[model samples]
Target: MSASTSAPANSAPVAHNALPPPSTSSAARSSRIAPHSHIKGLGLSPEGFANLDTAGFIGQNNAREACGVVVDLVKSRKFSGRALLLAGAPGTGKTALALAISHELGAKVPFCPMVGSEVYSTEVKKTEVLAEVFRRAIGLRIKETKEVYEGEVTELTPSESENPLSGYGKTVSHVIVGLKTVKGTKQLRLDPSIYEAILKEKIVVGDVIYVEANTGAVKRVGRSDAYASSYDLESETYVPLPKGDVHKRKELVQDVTLGDLDAANARPQGGQDIMSVMGSLVKSGRTEVTDKLRREVNKVVKSYVDQGVAEVVPGVVFIDEVHMLDIECFTYLNALLESPMAPTVIFATNRGNALVRGTTDVISPHGIPVDLLDRCLIVKTDSYTREQVSKVVQLRANVEGLKFGDGVLDKLAGEGEKSSLRYALQLLTPASILASLAGRTQIDIDDISEMNELFLDAKTSASMISESGAAFGS
Candidate 1:
């Protein structure tokens, strides 16, 4: 796929213009082709049969259209090497849509949310190290077959000179001290004693070794050179030298104060900090906090790098209540999003224009300029309709493994306008548990009545009275 080009700053949304209806023959042919070409793993048949009951589902047409746009961008290779953003209100399913797209792409998705403390805690040096680490991690070398060659070492030279003995004879002694290679290999000549020592040490043909000259200097001499015809008859091949060893990358290492690191590490090992935890729940229904936790998760996920593991799905970072994120966290996000493998970010908030009033200041605080926001596609999530609420209730009931009578869903859906899908799900959980306790096979109208009563009882009478008074007053 070609790299993504910059889109127009003020381009209008693509209009799905009217087209002539397909002919009967063409419709039949198209039906046999595929369901939705963009949506993968939905398990829909070629005729586009979806098991999801769409009777009560409403207002998702816009969301579906947005998803279609993303799919087209990917299919046309428009988003191949660029970052995209999805901004919306809380509970708008921005994350859900992004995840669906990621599922189709089969790419790695890094969920990074902005937090208050993370901003100032990340140091410049740490950022550099992280950059290098990320590069090495993603650009790991793959083992491949290549032709092997043998060559003679005419002379040995030390890259550094801290002359302990200074003279050429001394340097030569130090350089040739332990030179040894496989028998009959043309390389640096080695003494019989050194050859025997190397053999005893179990040095192999491909193994690299370092030789110390008599002058107290070190030089790399290849063992394979001894087999060359240029080598003296008494000479033996010299083993290749190994590269300098370095420590393995530390998972939890960060450029932050010791106290900050301690505080972060002290958080319950399984999850992230409270804010990020909440953000994750609000964003994408997943939570991970601290570099160590991320590493642990990555370890398990690495096995599915090119497989079906959902952990690697690209462009799926969901940040809820983004207004609450600290400046430092935003800065880190700005930098991270620029990375080629950065996840797609979905930032949701409720304050509307107030949250981003000072765009320049907000961007500057996070090291992201105004241009970044310009690239983000902002989508407003409208409130759910009555019909949508009914559908959500049924979907929730089905998910919780509750069998509800036909009219029971209608009763629950009509409770109040304030009730949302989330509330519906919450209500279903307790209702399902109670039904299980009661040994009931189905959640009939009686079950709904009991749940409603219990839900009412949980609230203070005074609060209920106030709500009633407010409703009447309105």
Candidate 2:
């Protein structure tokens, strides 16, 4: 051994091997969350409209551009009267386009999504259900400047006292919380109510929290960044040390959907007891909110908007399979779109000239009334090309953490071209299962072929059903 750089005479050989490393195997990290869970944004540049494969989206630049325009209109408050219609074939990413718009707008903007048949609830009037969704799509951003004790928690000691009402357990009289900011640290003798809030929030010594002085509300910001590099176990969201004094006036922006206000006012909770909560839950079983109560809530919301206490943020209401909404609901929707408190609406459908639901004689384009269609800016999403389908399949494989054997992806893409993109993507998981059963880690062409034979695509299934004489149309 070398003289100066030799190992210590008393050093144990396996001292560095104290703990095992984190697992990074495919089985450990694999997830089949959703087809579009990887979709984050519209996959476009912030300034120029650059068509690039980003945010798990492959193509459809035109639809994305139109959605971007709608997003712009939503932000500028000019998308009230008009609506955006996503007209496309199935699996062409219409819903994904709408979702991308909401993502582009940010999390504060409320985006209410519903199927057309959801309005056909037995308990509520169709118009009432539609009105509730419209209200939910609109957000009220309330800004409040309140005195809050905000800092990284250095110490959390709950002082306990004997309970006078119950002999079973002691009650927390007050909580001694030592809060530290960059400026200075302060100890707070908070109320017992605030201690309950702290327990509810799961606040620990390393967590950053803020206690509202007036309402006695406690909010956990996140864990302090000082302990971020300490260990790796459960996921940790580390935040920087709070700025300014431990006790300061912080301006908090609270976002609430209009439906939330209506519900709160309609069935106001009297107390925090189990009986009261149960009563509220039971009363909430009635789906419909009365029109008179909604009007009163609207008046209060308008006053709040007028007084500058809260600003109205109109968001998107995406109705998928909009053709299922009947003529009456469509009429109500037309009136709702023109209302002063209306939010931007986006419709999605795949129909061409077809019978409008609830109409025996009248045939409208896309199964929607001509009047509503005229008010919409139709953005068409094209079917995926063979190359695009291949790319999408590859993307899905990567997302699902599956290894593709030689020529497997090309074979799948060929199948996609023959049948449909949706059909091709559906075989991926089954093929992986087959490969696993055959003692192979990667899915080969044989696995793909076996899956193709076992499962029928939509087209093949339809053909079989037609042959069975089940009254299916050609």
Candidate 3:
């Protein structure tokens, strides 16, 4: 027998647009979350800055002064931020000025260098690309706490095969290391190569060891105190001092890009394997950060900064060949610069009265809008003097690790002033090679003269072509 119950007269039918809440079972199951990419190790080196700051930089004093002003403004922490455009002829040190600005910013501020054309991506909107770049320049000072091993190695055993070759099977399976500390002793499984490093370092029983978290490089720190004291003073057997623990909880302050944080937040709360089970539903660069996530990230950043555990470091984005950017990208910059999270943008261009990309309109100075140009602190670079050009050539020769005989550098520098800085520098490599092949240890006057002839020949050929084209047109 079947009994049917009637629905309540006052109850309305369920709407098709309404959906039930996600099942607990579904939440428990693995997710198909997308993988995120991180932006790390994207900063200028101090050494590079030093290179540009050197006397070898030669000339461009006015340009150098402008760079110094920008650096001071960034460091003052009061200046919001502004765009800097370095306008100059090619080989007039436009790129060099931008690099110098980045260097002067130092380690505290992140320096991100990208070309003008890199802002567009088929996979993402131009605005989104700009957003990512803005985020990249803005960093998160993460005070991360991780559980790590820090102790001494008491014993090490390697599992090996008697046969030298195992055609069908794997040999030298794994190595087991016994690490000790004041608290207790722990056994760790290590790779064969790691064990080899321990042996190569002569780390035996009672030696201290630690594993690097980023790289699984087994480092032998030192011998145990008990083993060290047993050896007499000035003994032939050098007993190293006792090392710290190999495994222990660690607190580190690290700089991470906002992009890196966004990628990490994309991971499923349950696990990544669950996402694999969900199939490839999520593709790269498609992960969206919700407002809630932004609040959480901001909270963490603020907490650390308040606690003196971290500090907000401003960043730089140097766009070389800024004229290459289309009008759309250029228009996007106006708002990007004014955003509360804007970075110090340095743009370099050699173009004067050029057509903006994707448009028939020709722009003056640089292919950028006048409004954007007005906002920029323009720094102009001029041609180098003969002596200054010589200094630069000598400086470059030193940088490239090339040895030149007496008077050769001066001759090259004079030639560079006549041709171009780039042409002059380009001659050094071939000249050095020629000198080497001719049984010479260092480049001399003859090498310089020979390279000059080759450069003149190429210049002559280009001129001949231009002349022929003009005659043909007539």
Best candidate (score: TM-score): 2
Q: CA lDDT, every prediction? A: 0.44, 0.84, 0.69
The candidate, 1 or 3, that scores higher on TM-score is: 3
lDDT of 2 by residue, 91-157 (tens): 9999988888888888778889999999987788889889999999989998888999999999999
The sequence of per-residue lDDT tens digits that candidate 1 reaches over residues 1-474 is 100111134542221222323455843542222212223332222343433433222345555455556555655646533444544544545544554555544433222333222222233333433332232223111222222222233343223335466554332222222222234332344444444455555555443444333322222244553344554554455544322221111121112222222334435444667886675455532122355654553454455444533222243445445555544444555676675544445555555444332244443312233454555565555666677777666665554456886687777777634545555555665555454444445665655666665665323466889999999999
Off by over 4 Å in 3: 1-56, 144-149, 155-250, 266-309, 452-461, 471-474
| Comparison by TM-score, 2 against 3, better one | 2
Task: Give candidate 2's whole-model lDDT.
Answer: 0.84
lDDT of 1: 0.44
- lDDT (0-100) at residue 466 of candidate 3? 99
TM-score to true structure, per model: 0.44, 0.81, 0.66
TM match of model 3 to true structure? 0.66
RMSD of each: 22.3, 10.2, 23.6
Worst 10 residues of 3 by lDDT: 33-42
